[model samples]
Target chain A: MIGKLNRNSTLLSSIISIILGMLVGAIAMLLSGYDPISAYGALFSSVFGSASDMGETLRTITPLIFAGLAVALAFRTGMFNIGVEGQLVIGSLAAAFVGLKLELPPVLHAIVALVVGALAGAIWALIPGLLKAIRGVHEVIVCIMMNWIALFLSNYMVGKVLSNNSDSTEKIHPSASIRVDFLTDMFDGARVHLGLILAILTTIFVYVLLFRTKLGYELRAVGLNPDASEYAGMSVKRNIILSMMISGGIAGLAGAVELLGTSEYLAINPSLPGTGFDGIAVALLGANTPIGVVLSSMLFGGLFNGGSNMQYVAEVPFEVIRIVFAAIILFVAANFVKQLGNRKNRKKKGEKASA
Target chain B: MLSTMTNLLETTILYSTPLILAALGGLFSERSGVINIGLEGLMTIGAFTSAVVAINTGSPWIGLLAGIVAGILLALIHAVATVTFNADQTVSGVAINFLAAGLAVYLVKALYDGAGQTPVVESKFTDLAIPVLKDIPLIGDPLFNTSPITYIALILVFVSYFVLYRTPFGMRLRAVGEHPHATETAGVSVVKMRYVAVLISGALAAIGGATLSTSIGSEFSATTVAGQGFIAIAALIFGKWKPFGVLGAAAFFGFSVALSLTGQVWGLTEYVPSEILTMLPYVLTILALAGFVGRANAPAAIGKLYERGSR
Candidate 1:
């Protein structure tokens, strides 16, 4: 269904979804006896308020884009990798382990840590993807279960292997850090790093990988119709695993950047870091396009970054932003515009159904 | 040793009540042809309302009722979006979760002067040993010495089974999920059935959350429900959409959770790492799904949109 839309209509529908989401948010604010205008004003200024704020916002957007792409890639392959959060956790743990424990030179160290993290993520996803391919198990259930498993495993990692604190590990080596000193100084002490550049490069790479390559065509074809693709001599099972692994790698990158670039250490938490579920919203909102994923994640990044300011400046709670995003996703999911288009093409689709 | 066994059983029953309730909730919704990953959201709303109302009214019953109503109200959005608007059910479910989560914290903050959690409620249910049954041996203690909600939940599985397999409504609801087109041709309103099922799903799942807040825990916090709703969904699938199957699955999961913490169940904790023990339920769930049980067969049209006149 996502593949059916032209680029322009996809953009138009997304804009409509965002508008609807904002309208719902405004109404929620008003009904709560809060001024929506002031809340929105605070939200705007929160991102544009200062150079540091802008840096933080960019940093926030980076992980979301990676997570969104992870979701979008699987979504395009007719798979729902609900385990992106699990993948992220494993990846982050791996990257943190490498960054903190291993001693190597600057650039090579970071690269090795990143590669290991992405591989960890891929391995984490491999379970569900293989199950889906070989045993016909639905990815949703396994992925959801894997999320809790990841939490426990990461907690153990933090507690046992790298416990400088009860709930957190020691910081990574500076050589393995992604944050550039020049960038930090430019942003007035912001911890914003080159992760945004990595995210953008990934976006471009994936866009090419998914659209411009024959392998991309094969992956998408399996997603659109696996039986037909198989009839066309494509190995459906292999493609499913391959797509899932690639998506898992990207999701791992999200965690790697988050830890290596932002936290520089791992923390043991009872809950997920939460990007996987949000990735579902980002991918849906972005219409599952690479460029769209980046754009939509920026919107999410801005909302999340601005939420505290909204709370402080307008006396509205930060959670109100979740409501807005939820509304946007609903609008996008219930795309009446797509229905209108579907109605127009029904004759062709109906004939094909019969044929 | 017998007493220790009984205590473990009691803990399992207490923990399993919410899972059983929530899985049954999933049973109703999925059997009616609508996907409801929003059980977590519904439970959250239920839990928050239950906690708040219990605090204000000093009556757990009223709070519980109010929680159910809140869940039903929130579920109405899901019903409208999926049945009325033909929205993607999974996406709609995700939205429902976001709405519930945001609304819960948002309201808590608004009501409590920016406090992150609710104060403990004194009126919540406490564990009870049934008068007649308490006199019985080890078996009776395990079976009866539990939260009253556990007994209600135990009875509910049979009730759910009867309702799903015995009643005319059950047949139509199943038909609606499996083949809405056929159900429609038989002069039944697929939309109405889905709405009823979803509301019931919301109510039960909410009660599950309320059970956690009011009975198991002393208060409502963001993490109180934790991922129990998702666990309930896993139980639903693990149970293969059957009430009795879900009861057993939930009990097993609850047992895993209950024993994993203390390692008193066969003293496994002595040998196993606490982390490994904690990971047991999820790992076991995956193994169960991948093993001889094979794939869980959902309703034929579980995730598909049911258009009235279109194929």
Candidate 2:
């Protein structure tokens, strides 16, 4: 049944599925005695209501863009980097520590802090990658365990060492703070900074690197079939490590943007942050494409920003958004399974015909 | 010194119970070829359901049963997804986790009028003291005087070990996981074995949750299980997926947790932030997984779809 569906038609079907999912969500809201229209209206208004609201949405989207890209990149390489949450936390802490201690010009300080953050994330991700590559450890198990370590370690460091007797880290030095007075002025006191531009550039970079480069081809080939890639003379082990490092670096940059652009300080209890895990769902929904990740990030950001208002207006709990997200994941996963089934059936038919 | 030692031993046993139960649950699923990543979520559901039911019915026994049933139901979702739909086991497991969490929270709010918790219950599991055994010095109270669930869990460990190694059923379960087609060709029903194993996994995990609510906290909280499910998974791997090995790994993690909390009480490491000590289990998990156990082997068909028409 699915083999008959063209690529364009499948894409259309997926879009229709999303729309149908939203409708189902609306029905759920209505069944629960909430005004679905008003709730959705509040959601859209909250995200695009005013210049300030738009800025907040953009600020939120900035880090999501990087994190989503990070997760998507790893997914393309057939690695499930569940440690992105941990990587992001450690990266943020690393950048915040560097940002607070550094005394350089604003651009240089910011750049240095971001680089430190990315490096930290890369190093953090490398542990699991190395375990997978050399020791034959499953990345999922290692990454999940590493996330806990990162969370606890970062919490301890922020609480005991960098906290200055407070719950949060010392504020980043003036030089390290990425000021976006230009955009702020344009938006009349909005927090949207140059990080958005950087995020977009990073997305484009990821796109080109993944699709346009020989290295990207090799990485994708390794992801598709490690044995085949090895047969074709691709170094699967090196590609695996390189892909993970790049994945972690992107996620780490996300942490830097969140700290420097929005949070401006580090909190001791940076549990999960939701962005890293949410990135998994985002990447899945986006089909692990750069453009797909951006659009999916926007959808997720909107849901988060809107869910708050939905709670305010409908008196429904904000956790409804989590349900919605989970539902989408379930549907997408089911779709993937169905697609796999179709492919298997097609293969069998081809074999029979040849025989 | 005797009192401190007894306290430490008691704490270790207490912490190890849940880990052992959950890991034993995971053992069933993974050994049967299904990657039970939803173990955590199933445990959560079990914990919440058992707590709520126990509070309502004023029967710890009934609550325990309900917890097991709740866990089985959730595990069934995972079974259907991976077994029938052939969905990605990890993704489906994650989806189950998120869904269970959201559904549980939503139900709590809806039923409790947004209190985010159920009211405290009067009924809970009381520890069983072996009549003469409880009179022994030091080790007696900590070891002999405990909840019935502890003894049940210990018995389960032995039973599971025997089941996994001694029985024809055990042989078939392992065979299906290692080679489903071969098992099927040998006239064993692979699907039936997988279904049973996963269901058993769910029930055990749920019982673990029930133990937490009825024996430890006497109330259900969102963070009650708090990644204990993942700890069980680590314990399973750390123990090389063997039943007794998993039990030992669970005890090891339990010791770390017990030590951390005990350190706070004894003022041994009071100056150090308790969070660092709390993180010891996960840190240890990563380290153990990184190299200590050498190469961990998963079932050959462990997350792969077993389609009759395909392979």
Candidate 3:
């Protein structure tokens, strides 16, 4: 497999994977005695039901976009940052701490909280990156361990250090909140905030960083062929650590955005957040590209938003979305349509090979 | 203090059984040139199967068998995808984890009148005390007076060590992982070896799940297999992929888990928060890999797709 996928081939494979995933999900629903049509109908219809629905859908998409970008960046840099869940929680904790404890001007408070949160996530990721670069430890093993540590540490801090008489911290000060009153009014009181605008801006920023910058070129070169990059006088270790920190920063930003714009506080989480895990599927489906991640996140965000509707209308658990995504991931991995890609490329003067 | 030590040892052995079983399973797959990160998913399915079957049939033994069969079926998918189609093993593994996590809970809800967890099975493994062994002052109670599964798991470690190191099949398995092309030239069917290894890996990992549900945990829930599958992987790395080493590593992890709880009783929680205490196993895993153990000595051909054309 080459380091990057050809656009035409990737588009075809992604479509086929989504179709196959839906088919399998349908079969599963039928076997379970649930009505697949009604369930799926309820899922999408809910996303388009009203202005409020649209706003809520945007809210769901916000964190996923950040998460997808985080995963995509790491994928581009030849590392699997599965510790995103840990980083996100730690970032949220940091943001909540900042938002609650600090006093600052309205614009400055939110900005400062966001920066601190992203830095928290970056620091969490730095450990595994450093270990992989310096000690030759597998990043996956260390990341998985860190996920648990992050969870427990955050859980302790949330319940003991941050609790304001209940399971969650007190709502953040209004100065630190990213809630946009005009957007809220337009969406009929839905909690749509500045996070969506931030998401789109970040996507464009990632595109420019990866495609039009010297550092991005060096980082991806190291990812594709570390030995060759090292021979070319690039510092592979430094690149590895740098990319991990950036990926982690985005992951932290995801947590920070959700805390500031939506949840507005931190709660005791019993399990690792699924959004961090979902980033893997998003990146893979997007072919690890910036713009592609936004599109993929949009699709996933719709499915997830409609999940509650599926529960209410068709009596199916929202978890079916996970199963469908899992199947899609499997199909993507198998690359069943690679032959199609190969055949199409054969007639071209310069054909790109695929994984 | 001796009594406390014995109690702690008892808890350690009690908890380590599942890790020993799962890590041993991981050894087989990695030894045959496949990376099986789906141990968590396989265990989740196993835990679900055993819980459901045991609740229905009133026999944990039958439940255990069904769990194993379920694991083999799921592993066949992994084998076909990764071994036959050359899919990325890690991708396949991540897919399996999500699939199992969602499916088991969904099925439980469907089968149990919308309940989120399986009803606790009435037919559970009873703790046993080997008569004479149980009488030995300190070691006996801690080591011998526990579930029968613990004894079987300990015995299997030596059995696994012998099978991997001394037996012809074991040698062939290791050879494929180390040098599949050489093994292919020598007339061993690399594909068949890998398929067998992956399937065995699934079965043993399932047993680990079964141990949790029927032998120890008593029920299947969304959190039943939680992160035990991942912990088993850490144990595999800590053990350095050797059978005896794996056994020791699994035991060490189990001790960490047990100590997380027992330390509270001993007033150690006064210094360390309970949540921090619970993080011991995970933290130790990272620490060991980073500096204490240095690099992991993974099999040479692990995570690589063996293309017959290249061979």
lDDT of 3 by residue, A267-301 (tens): 87777887888888888899899988988888888
Model 1 misses residue B81 by how many Å? 1.7
In model 3, what are the clashing residue pairs, if there are any?
Answer: none
Per-structure clash totals for the candidates: 0, 0, 0
Which residue pairs clash in candidate 1? none
Task: Tell me the tens digit of each residue's lDDT in model 3 across B1-311.
Answer: 88788878988998899999999999999999888889999999999998899999999889999999988888888888888778888778888889888888888877887788888788988888899989999899888888888988999899999999999999999999999999999999999999999999989999999999999889999988888888898888888889998899899888887887787789877788778767877777787787674555889998888978694
Off by over 4 Å in 2: A1-6, A16-41, A164-166, A182-191, A336-355, B270-276
* lDDT digits (tens) for residues A230-281 of candidate 2: 9999988898899999999998888887888788898866346767878888
Best of the candidates, TM-score? 1
lDDT of 1 by residue, A107-209 (tens): 9999999999999999999989999999888787888899899999999889877884378988899999999989998888878998889999999989999
Residue-level error in angstroms, candidate 1, position B17: 1.0
C-alpha lDDT values of all predictions: 0.89, 0.83, 0.87
TM-score of each: 0.95, 0.92, 0.94
Off by over 4 Å in 3: A1-5, A164-167, A339-355, B1-3
